[model samples]
Target chain A: MSFKTTVITILIYFYAACGATAQEPTNYSAKNGLPTNHVYDVQEDKDGVMWFATNRGLVKFDGKNFKAFTIKEGLPNNDVWELYLDGKKRLWVFSKSRYQSYVLNDSIYNFATSDGKTISPAPIYEVDNALWLRAGYYKFDGAEFKVQNDYATFYHGGSQQVFQKHGLNAEAAAVSYDFIFNQYFLIKDGELWFLNADGTVLKK
Target chain B: MSRRDSQSAYRFGNLFILINDKGIIVINTIAHTLKHIAFKDLNIFIQPFDTNQKCVFVNNTYQISVPNYLLIFNAGFELIEKHPFPEALEIHHAFKDSRGHIWACSFKKGIFLYTAAQLRTLYYLKGKK
Candidate 1:
């Protein structure tokens, strides 16, 4: 073999040797410890335990094993949507079927409106200090969730008018708060509305 | 070493990987060479995320998730494997955990766990207790 040809052949083998080794992944499914293979959300708690929210149940994993929880275990609903950890280290579980909160020492608490309306886990978000959950924005006052009606009014920069949330022609697509400017922004029919700290209308 | 098209960029050792809507561009800082890895046949927009740079997988790193596929490449910017997920309509986000495992969210189906060379499908199912 020619000297240059041998050099190229050795280089090919060297490159192949440096490639990744063929190692397959280890899967855990219903056949194993997990209650079901389908997992909507997976989160790790402060204690390092992994929590899996599934369609039929909620599963907890401690690195090796899986423990399932559902309505039978005091959870409000079976079909879980997402899991949120609030500032107080409390884990809040949202579900399209039901909503619940879990504390380490305390038991799971069901969430509902003051008027006896069960909060559905659809448009839930942890914005600023309080949670934008259910049909209203609420915060945990160390005992229960209290809905805040302080943000009842908002401004519209396009029409140059202010409208209440219950106004006849008022339509709100999405609502969010901006921490930087300490204001609330709402998207209504593709128009941006900014609200001051006191829920008063602000110009765009 | 510089690419403006990518929304995210990652550096591994002497190589810099830039990803955008088109494909991944791998640049070797020491060699002063740029190599483009195209996935045009797949018809998917490629994006890059921060991962363990020393995982010893593709490119002395790990895997990256495309919209419907997980592409694993080597340090030489060569294609290692293309793991497809037809059920995953769209991937909302993809990131690597502290355990060197890549997690991708499908938004509708469920989250996917990609570790080693195996793709484990975690379906969103529920059980009572």
Candidate 2:
């Protein structure tokens, strides 16, 4: 082979040798104009906009443009934990304050917001519009977070699954893209826990 | 998976919050299989027998930033290949699929399907001629 051909061949071979590795991250922080660098959770809104639950506040990012919200914005709480998009495309945010708040789709309300009472057995996800929260020992007002007789019925509204704290203040759990068959998971006791439809935790 | 290899890998961090901080390492499964456990690494439950198998996997990429370098490893854990990916990508996952496809996911950059000589080279790694 000619020297030029050999050199090009070697270059191609060298290039191919280096392309194998791991994957990359798609989301960006304030570097991408988000409100904060510490983003706890991110979910796609109905309109395809991405909402970030940040340490600073709530942020909405379209392909272009970013909007931020915080306690100053009349939100009952500012420290957000779980970020959920409901069946109606409305947004629900759970915070460390224990209150659950709701925002309508399309941000139509500039003057109204739904700030529910401090919820114990804090929220996890929204399955079909109902809030699927953890049914652990949580209390509201003076009621310590505890489970009651009606606790069984709560899972029907989606609390049937059990998930453990992944780590320090982690609010996300494993969600099977296939929602049915009850295959979602969370790490508990060093084992993968699957929330059974019958309110039982199964080892994965 | 075996102690034979240097397990000398660093943790990978993701810039996207959509993903949680995970424990992911890009390893040549074939090399792990070859160095120690015989038929086990193939995800095989049964069947055994082998010498120093070259194993599967074309290469592993070690990126400090984006699409970086393709790393090749021999039976002795020596790097025998080094390919560069200049596409400026962000990958998410890497492993062999059920269909013998060597898959890799980019961090929203896009997924790559190995075709042509790259796939050919990977076959050569897994004992395929």
Candidate 3:
């Protein structure tokens, strides 16, 4: 073989080797013990049990086996849209069309929302002993979900209005209390902002 | 007549909504009775997101033609927005990510990521050749 052709062949082999070494994500589906292939959300609880919210039901993967919970198994709705692991270590399951709240303890427990209305499947955050739920910030004290004081400010209404206290224009993505800075950190629209105790934005 | 090959299903209030080759099917989970609505002109072939928070409707008027437009329905099943698909992409399914981004899949092509804030198709993939 010519030296030029040999060099070209070696380059092709190198490229193929690199492509073969690239890792591809392992795809899981109904065939692989998943309840349904249309998994919307996934979460891992404190106990290391992986939960998957699928179109058919809620599936739990304990690294070895897959357990599915459906309407036949006492779920009010078959379609599980979202899953959340809250501060209390409770697995909160939200459905697409149902008003009942399904929580996972030793098993799934069904309960009604505070207003007997369906909660929108959105992001849920725990902050200051309360929950930043889709509709608004609320405190669920076992029996009922109570709306917090700063509901109007904390709740996003799709408007780009600056909050009165924080002077932030966007809605908060997540909030965390920083012990190092002795302040509260608010992550909103990918930007991090520090807040004072009075909720005013602290320029930093 | 019953439509076969269901793409997706969701719950709206007390009704279990299913999207098949037909437009939309509403079934009462408790009564196990199908509620028929006078759904006209909407040949909904897909139910992109599992969450009833939003609905994306695609119409394929021609049997062999690709859909040109997409209808977005809010949680209430009201028409919220209508988007035209890019020139020749055939979308099969779509879903919302945890970050609230809408992603659509194509049978021949790969996937497309759409951002609501930008009101445009942010990314597209034609899949590996």
User: What are the DockQ scores of the candidates, in order?
Assistant: 0.07, 0.04, 0.02
Give one digit per residue, the lDDT tens place, for model 2 in A1-204.
999999999998875664342222233545666665554444555665656565676776655677777877645556554465555656666565544465654342222112333442132333333334443322221222233324434434444233322221224432321122333334333344444544354444
Q: Which stretches of candidate 3 lie over 4 Å from their true place?
A: A1-22, A97-106, A147-204, B1-129
Return the TM-score for each candidate structure: 0.51, 0.38, 0.43
Candidate 1 per-residue C-alpha lDDT over B6-107 given as tens digits, one digit per residue, 9 for 90 to 100? 233444445545554556656454454556666675555444422211111232544555455567666566666555554334543344444546555443
For A1-204, candidate 1 gives per-residue lDDT tens digits of 999999999997864453322222344566667666556555555665667677777777677777777888778787775665555566677665334566363256766544344554433434345555533444545555565555322222422233453241434434444322345445455455566655576653
- Please rank every candidate by TM-score, starting with the best: 1, 3, 2
Deviation from native of the Cα of residue A124 in model 1, angstroms: 4.5
* Each prediction's whole-model lDDT (CA): 0.51, 0.38, 0.48
Q: In terms of TM-score, how similar is model 2 to the real structure?
A: 0.38
Instruction: Categorize the docking of model 3.
Output: incorrect
| TM-score between candidate 1 and the true structure | 0.51
**How are the candidates ranked when ordered by DockQ, highest leading?**
1, 2, 3
Cα shift from native, residue B52, model 2 (Å) = 40
**Which candidate should be chosen as best, given DockQ against the real structure?**
1
lDDT of 3: 0.48
> How many clashes in candidate 2?
28
